[model samples]
Target: MTKDSVAAVLERLSRLYPKNIDLSLDRMFELLKKLGNPQDDLPPVIHIAGTNGKGSTLAFIRAFLEKSGKSAHVYTSPHLVKFNERIVIGGKQISDKQLLDCLLQVEDANDGAPLTFFEATTAAAFLAFSAYPADFVLLETGMGGRLDATNVVKKTVLTLIASLSMDHEDFLGHTLAQIAAEKAAIFKKGAVALSQKQLPEAQKVLETYANDRGVTLKSEGKDWKIFISKEGFYFNDTLFPHPALKGVHQYANAALAIAAVKELNSKWLANVTDSQIAAGLIDVVWPGRMQPLKDFPLPEGWELWADGGHNPGAAKALADFLPEWNDKPLHIVCGMLTTKDSENFLKQLAPFADSIHTVPVLNALHPGRSPADLAKIAESSGFRNIKIEDNISHALADLTAGRYAPGRILICGSLYLLGDFFSSNKGVKNDRQ
Candidate 1:
């Protein structure tokens, strides 16, 4: 019998449990127990959770750690192109052989018992992280933090919370405070918690939780502030180099990472100098969030970019950054999952776009809203001159044929669509940051 590839093994393991997301730690704990509870042996954890900016924040933190001569084992979810992108040991993606071996071991430990795909994969990541030697494990919650598969860590060195907004309404609660409560569960006693500026309601929830748990919570604006300028941003009066990642929002993300690093400098993560933090800011790369597509063929003066942001909060971030591109008229090419609030998401972007091109998220795991449906949503969201296309390539071809002024083209919305864009477009490297 031939050995199964990583893809085949992942597909088989996915069938061992229900398809829908059942946010609970029961199955995860059970599997870890069978595997001798590798979660307990992991290096000091920096658990992160929130609606958006989790990946970008984690990327910034990893960059800081690497710059300080530290190696970290990191785990994030929803790989854009390959499954291996989700797991990194010592700042490198998990090799296929090691990933397959870990998955097989996790499969054996499960003995065909019930488990979600994320739970099984997360278990494999923990096992691998435990075996490997690293200074810290930077863990991003798969979904809501309270019952997320990665929340199995009993104690963490610190908990980082990024921007919070309405997302995953079904699994996480609908209200902002409820969602904040769910994510704030990651704050452990004796661990410092840091958060980005949040809505008043969400802020109250997080503050209440932190106070009850006796965790010191430092929030943006209240505790630490980032002052942006034409040259660069300042974190709590300490000026830092501009981040390599695009957009003004990144300054806040970098500040959050810097704050976490400073909070840990005295104990778990020492020797992270100001110079190292500045270097990390300049070198950090978090692809698919307003990343330019330099390799794709384009007419002279025409620019192409992509962002994997499906929620209104992400859309607002993109909207805030769009004004900086006033030199060129911006045209948006968007594809979204059916589960997303397409109208709300488009509403945030509608004001800035000269035209909106709607397409289906071809590579999404679940069904995507039809192009026509998305266009209708865009229209309702106050966008005019909306066009429906088969996919991204067709959208670009249409844009080229239109001979519109050499404006900017932004492929926005679902991460799965971004994955499809990367897969179809040759020379586009999906570099894991």
Candidate 2:
């Protein structure tokens, strides 16, 4: 099958279910059973769950394994540009023909039962992974971990919980502790559990859960720490050059990846030389997470960065990175779905941004807050310079033409918005392309 054909099949599958995300394991387990229980046949799996940083952590692990000459399968969510980006088999994206064939097989097995798009896609990914051979499989949970479709796997070599925060209030929970407990449900007995630094309440909840399950908890600042310097990050007393990915948060994610590698302690991984680890750390790449668009169709001397940070915790991280820009008069273009905490997100970002441009997300699963509504939220959050735009291009144009000096523009908020930008600017080439 061609790429277009594969996309068509995926679109059909997406329409089969009315809801985009229905976090439950029963339907997924039944579907997997009908598909011949492929999830049980995967390689040593490393499951990652968190409000943010999961995808970047997965990228780091994949790069590390690949640099060591080992094969890995990776599954991530909310593709930036292509649907196929969600599944990586043996260090390469599953080919269009392979994805289409696997989707058809899954559909045949489901017998037309109602299943969310994420559930069906996850089932298809497991089917493809089971068919292929690899040393490790890195899986990122779609939402909260416990009932997430990806949580059905009975056993995993390593499970990582990245920096947890308050997100997905309606589906997961309203408070940090509640949400942390939902994510902590992925901790299987005897699995090596690694966690990033969390809020006090979240940390306590996760610690209690890990203790009860007898999972070895290798935590940041306790079992391992990362020191950032002018040269790069120092992980476990080993210095590495600046990661290939940008942003300070990346150092934390890299540290978590290194911790996971150490916990695996496999002979194949033990054979990895320091040079391999350094090279992999410097080579990792994950899109729409602090991704810079320096070479896009934008004007010269103007910098554009994109991130899919929709929650307050992510907003705080983005704010922390803003000071590094050094009074460049930052312009923020944001679009968010209605389910997100728009007021809190804007409150966290208001102090650092010179101006805010609110736009609507394209093909958003839930009702998208209009640009005007979002601008109002920003204004209520103490931002004076807020404007509503019809779309990202208009927002970019206004930001570039406005009084702000030749500073940087940050396009952020929802991953769905990033996908829309990618679709509209398909012909605009970038260095990564």
Candidate 3:
């Protein structure tokens, strides 16, 4: 592959727009018009938006649909390892050649237009989905839902909203209601909207938005519920196996996905069985979320884990799961972007972690907080023992120097940091597949 490769094309596309995120659909609409409005030709779209658990919920939905013998075209953002991981067609990651061709075609149609990288690449994804065949298109918003590039789809089969929180307040809004409205904007008329458990303020806003759009809203606690029993978990009356993914929040994520699948079966997957749902629950694979790192350069009896949780909501989830590792003292290796709420994020996890090691996310598109600065934040967040490391390598070496007892080491904070780790460290398997 030469300069026309997908990576090269993506790099060139990044410079097409001056601002990284304009958060407007005008440029995306214009680009789609040039490409014959490929978004209109896609299969039944399942548009998802929220603060946290969007990716995990989508993963569960994909697993359920695929196990039921259905193929879907998936689009998600912030690729951990490669850009190709963001787009999957018919149960397969988009090939480099195919992606390159679509990107080049989009570039040609774009004709050097000033669209954000997300908008341009999303245009390419829609183009590829239009040219391919699939039962559904699982579209995830890159940022806020109202003006997000992926929200160009006029109609959708089901609109799913995961747990909403305050993460991107700068672009979305300052209050929870404001952010909720931005995400609830994805709801289309006649499209039944389903949401996971939400804060009271967010739930009220979502209800108002759903009513204004004449869309039926099915909420987790109100419309349906997941009950945990001595044996296993159940989504309403249907029994489900425990989710393969770690963390207790996965039960709620799985329930939301199972509900979405049930809603889809009436029109699309008519023959999906409860057995299939159980299989999907255990077969799902979502990387960089409480992922266990094995065969890495850690000493014996020492464990390494990685997650992309950068917000307070995600930190709460991590803190909830930390108690499970009570046998091992937890040492945190964290790196975050300058845009995130590092203080609140650290505050949520500081109570659970024994020590905090701050590092910088290498080669991130956005600027990362310096290790020294992050250490200061950790100190302010109630972490007494804080260390500033040059990078993950240095942190790992120091942690394994036999100074402290052998325990678990978690590399978390930003998805970009996890991506850097995956790219730089060799032979460290996280079982993403």
lDDT of 2 at 180: 96
Off by over 4 Å in 2: 1-4, 18-23, 266-270, 427-433
lDDT per residue as tens, model 3, 186-279: 9999789999999899999999999887999999998889898767798878777888888988888888888898898875654667898899
Local distance difference test, each candidate: 0.89, 0.85, 0.88
Model 3 scores worst on lDDT over the 10 consecutive residues at 424-433
TM-score of each: 0.97, 0.94, 0.97
Residue range with the least summed lDDT across 10 consecutive positions in model 1: 14-23
Instruction: Find the number of clashing residue pairs for candidate 1.
Output: 0
Score candidate 1 by lDDT: 0.89
Determine the C-alpha RMSD for candidate 2 after optimal superposition of all C-alphas.
2.3
Give the per-residue Cα lDDT of candidate 3 at 340. 93
Candidate structures ordered by TM-score, highest first: 1, 3, 2
Task: Give the RMSD in angstroms, all C-alphas superposed, for model 3.
Answer: 1.5
Number of backbone-clashing residue pairs for each candidate, in the order shown: 0, 0, 0
Best by TM-score: 1
- Which prediction has the highest lDDT against the true structure? 1
Clashes of 3: 0
